[model samples]
Target: MKKFINRIFLLITFTAFAFNINAQIDLDTVKSQKFDTGKMWSFDYPPVEHFKEAYGLETNEEWFEDVRLSALRLPGCTASFVSADGLIMTNHHCARRVLEELSTKEKDLIADGFFAETLEDEIRIPNYYADQLVFIKDVTEEVQAAAETGETADEKAKNKEEKIKELTENLEKETGLRAQVVSLFNGAKFSLYGYKRYDDIRLVFAPEMQIAYFGGDFDNFTYPRYNLDFTLYRAYENGKPVQPEHFFKFTLNGIDPNEPIFTVGNPGSTQRLKTVAQLEYIRDVVYRGYAFVYDTYYNELEKLKTVAPERAEEFEDIRVNIGNAQKVITSIYKGLSDPYLMARKKDFQRKLQEAVWNNPELKEKYGTIWENIEKTQTELRQYGPKIMAYTINRRFTPQYFSIAQKLVDFANELQKPEEERLPDYKGDKLDSTIQSLYPEELDNLIENTKLAVWADFMRMQLGDDDNYIRSLFGNNKGKDAAEYLLKNSIIDDRDKVIELAKEGADAILNSGDPLIVFIKESQEQLKDLREKAEEISNTTEIYDDMLGQVIFKIYGTSIPPDANFTLRISDGKLASFDYNGTKAPLFTTFYGLYDRWYSFNKEYPWSLHEIWTHLPDDFDMSTPLNFISTNDIVGGNSGSAIINKNKEVVGLAFDGNMDSIVGNFIYMPHNNRCVAVDVRAIVHSIDKVYKAKRIADELKAGKIVD
Candidate 1:
């Protein structure tokens, strides 16, 4: 027995030699999370060497551009062309809001699936569009050169801003495309992106909301998911279906464990490159406070929802947003609090500082960047809460309050020259701003309930003793105050609000609307707070921009830049990992989904669509459903195309596992994963179950499945 025990000890000691990071406990530090820079590779400079070395794929510029053009950028998600006739595929959740808006009380399209049998049956989404990146140029030298002409920091900043604006305008005019100057690596590099936009986006097909959000909030951010979260839409040009030159061909049985895959999409944002100090400030102060603000609203909404359970369905949109926000902030907070992650961040900072500060020339120019940022962050702690609560933009997000704020700001901006006005009040954007100044059609009862909830929360944030607060609330600090504003403000009266908004500052100041009066009285203090906040913000930007230069000087393209809601190609593999003393499967099948419905006793989220239960004999229960990949993703990557090296669509990214929630800062591929709907799953359901023959036929015509 003693000999056997000794042998077991020796075997355990040598386990790392056998399993390495795959070992049960992974004795290696978090640094063992190789490829942690978050493969959010940008178009400007991809890690071509790493790709070649890791995947044995020798890719050229043509290949890069072709892959880049294949994906389309949505307002809050990403999608891709799947057919030559511009059939686009994305996450079903991405189209949830649009579906909700289209639903009639009689025919709830969101509850029941929407499958347009004919092309003419497709529904158009107004004011919605998708952009394809058709043009890109490196304008870093010109932008930085302009900044160098300034005698002072402020002047340098202004010079840079003006130059960027000029460059964007000239590019737009030259190419007749929408041009945007994107800052990469903080401001170390700048690239001009020109997109070809299609305004006429239409709904193609959607699964029932129940299947799309199976397990709902409980399963969100967790792995072992069985959700079929795919949607199809189409783009049109000149009232005709667009024929896209580049698109991903659907591939069946497209994945294998540890096989290389790539996710092409816009990843929204990531703070992976932030300094330890900056992250600490966010973790300790910023995120916690922001989380509270969002949760307060959620709690209040939940309470109101409880009061009128019949209207519970009305709050889903905001509730989903609030839940997501809360989860994100809290997860980031938790990740930062992790001693191991913090230690890794600290070590990384120490090593980078050592390299940066040791080079005499680099040190002299950029040594103080981090210190300046730290100081500014401290100052920010003072004014951030105040500005967040009281600023015109931050204070009012709901349409009614937002309209009142916009009207007041509009009147104020009208007093200035076009160049001097707030930028949003300056160009084509001004017209849209003006048009949105009037409230959208709203139900009085629904508006009152939500508005009262918001009003009560604001009062709590800004105590009654506050001059503006007292003026707005008087002594009534609850629903009464909210009701009073609703009654007194002509802002709710669309025609009246429009007339006053057009009459300019004179009309606004003399108007007797209590909401308007409250805003006017608050403007002076708000202005002072804003100026202080902007000063710190501007300074911080300059320093961070300099820091970017320093980091580039040190790391170059070896590390990817931060995500900024732009197209980035992330490379990884379809893989599984050991978890909870067991193994996680690479893919979940339709069998598991059915099992879930039965096990949960057909409850709401777990309830299968009635059609699903009576599936045809041709339906394949063993078909792949959801799967996990090591791909790096963030919020806006919702509908990114997961493709193989041959550019064949394999899966559609929708969510990430809970461990990936920390991917906002660190990517632990050892466990963290991007969850996707298998391409076969999407096609299987449409063909065998929903009988979406038109879509299935189109897909089959274009498929390159093995």
Candidate 2:
């Protein structure tokens, strides 16, 4: 009777499996959305028709030019001219490093905040500059023609580089501005951008880090935020603030729910154009390994803070950065793990493949591209672990190993003739190279901790039986191995390293130092792997360009190119979304800020500064602090100015919600949102909390107010 029941169940399971296999869905039936690639519309190819259809706004070239002129690109973030007298607005986090540098023994600007009462009071920041896009010209045909002259992938890549250099230099000479050849859609299109750089940037106003980064790591990337993440700066020229023709006026009337909004800024890189095979490699190997590295370093740094109390602040900063990276990596890994999202990506890839294979010209030119990419990814998977293990990542590997590697390279380079030496070791670059090779200070404890973490990662990835792992750690591992290596390695001492380097290549190579020996033994293998990877990359890039061409041919400018940190305009609406089984509001208020503070017992990250602890009677608790918009954004979109159709500043783009992390590969407008500091909150904070009436009055007047 038992055997009979088992037979019946096996029969039923087999029948169900057969039926499911027979009913599999066809690739042809899978549909792709228009905005699946996102609305990161390039300035070179603005989505005029789409804008008209979506917002009923007839935007022209003049309007785009004005919008472009108003925007500014910082070192790694974005900003905009908010007032006529060069009053620039950006996120507080973006200016944190500058604030630290500006602080003196008498004052801690980062802790107490800063406000320049008069024009002369603004502090000039050295080696800091902001770039305004002054001119743009399409140079696609010229670049493609140059690339076509090459007969091989390597030759094509070289020719393309040379052509871009030539075009950039020419543009710089013509416009008398910093010029760059911006590649769009993976080299399908190229545009020359000339930037009018403002070198004399000064800090005008900044909020305390406590408020700027309120809620801290726990609340980063989460929506319904109440943080006042904003700062003001002034761009000076010839000892005075220049009156810019184009700038966004700070609107007193705040944003409304579902209102059309635009974000114009330099969004960094995105991988929406990458092949499915490449994305799979990133999902399974690249990001996974990176996530592990970030997690390990972050945890180790946290532990280090307890032991190294004097450097607690420094360690905390590093930990915060690592925590942020870990979050992004894990989020991307999660997104890639989603079956539905992966299916959508597959459907989009299939659509592209069908479009190509349907045409004889495209099929002959790009048929093997996907298959070749898959083959490359397979090869990369084999080498990926080894590369990850040996790579001299600053965050993971000890500085002594890096210094040793540099010393070895220096000795080798010195052996070569002047003409045969690499650029870094020749002429004007030699002094800088030597100076960098011998640093003034070395943090022994931090470096050893990093080494221990790295040893553990290597053991995990490469296994205990692996040759290098076995040699480095016979029976011991982790902390023991790290200590042994540091104890035996003479490179840890700057004087010893300099002397060894001075003795020439033979002495450095035969040093028998544990770190040096390991580097030397793995040098040949690392070099070979790097060469092979570069070759594969060159081939992949050539095919990528071809794929880009086909994509452009099929969709034209309707599908905006993948972001490359060049200025772009993305359109969306101020909106709310569902999260954690509850609806997030379109805007959050100061009342919610206090709620979080009190809810957490006013402890740490959520704690308010002294000034913010007791608010004035006039300070409106109902004032909106932060808001959400469906606008597409990424890492580099921080400090982007969110603007309305009238070109008024509505908010400052500082972050993206958790859902937006997947924006790296695809944009889902339904849930993904840009988190921004409300412009009204900035005005109110300046007027009531900081009591900077001069800056507040200028922001209101859109000019310098006495």
> Which candidate tops lDDT?
2
Clashes of each: 0, 0
Q: Give the TM-score of candidate 1.
A: 0.80
Model 1 C-alpha lDDT per residue in residues 1-706, reported as the tens digit of each score: 9999999999898875667644444323444234555789998897689889988988888888888888999989999999888899998888988888889888687789799888899999988999999998999999989877767667878899999999999988888888999999988999999999989999989999889999887678877999989889999998888998898888885687756899999999888878877888777566755665566666666776778788776665566666777778778888888777776776666677888789999889988888888998888777665555555433324467667777878988988888898877877787677777875676665566556655655565566676656656566755787767766678678888877876777898788777787666666667887788787877777888888898789989888889999999999887787777688899899899988899999986688778888989989899989999899999999999999988889999999987888888887888889999998989889998899887887886773222
Model 2 Cα displacement at 401 (Å)?
2.6
Who wins the TM-score comparison?
A: 2
* Candidate 2 lowest-lDDT run of ten: 22-31
- The Cα error of candidate 2 at residue 317, in Å, is 3.2
lDDT of 1 at 34: 42
Candidate 1 runs further than 4 Å off: 1-34, 104-106, 296-318, 392-523, 577-582, 703-706
Question: How well is each residue in 1-706 modelled by candidate 2, as lDDT tens digits?
Answer: 9999999999999999987875685645656687889999998888899999888989999999999999999999999999999999999998999999999999899899999989999999989999999888999999989888888888988998899999999888877899999878877888999999999999999999999999988898898788899999999999999899999999979876656899989898899988889899988777877776778778888888789788887988787777778889889988988766777788888988999899998899888878988988888877777887888886677787788788877878988999999898888887677777877888888888887878877776687888788666555677898876666678677878777776777888777776777787777698888888787788888778887888888889888899888899999998789998699998899989999999999988788889998788899999989999999999888899999999999999999999999999989999999999998999999999899999999999999887
Local accuracy by lDDT, each model: 0.81, 0.87
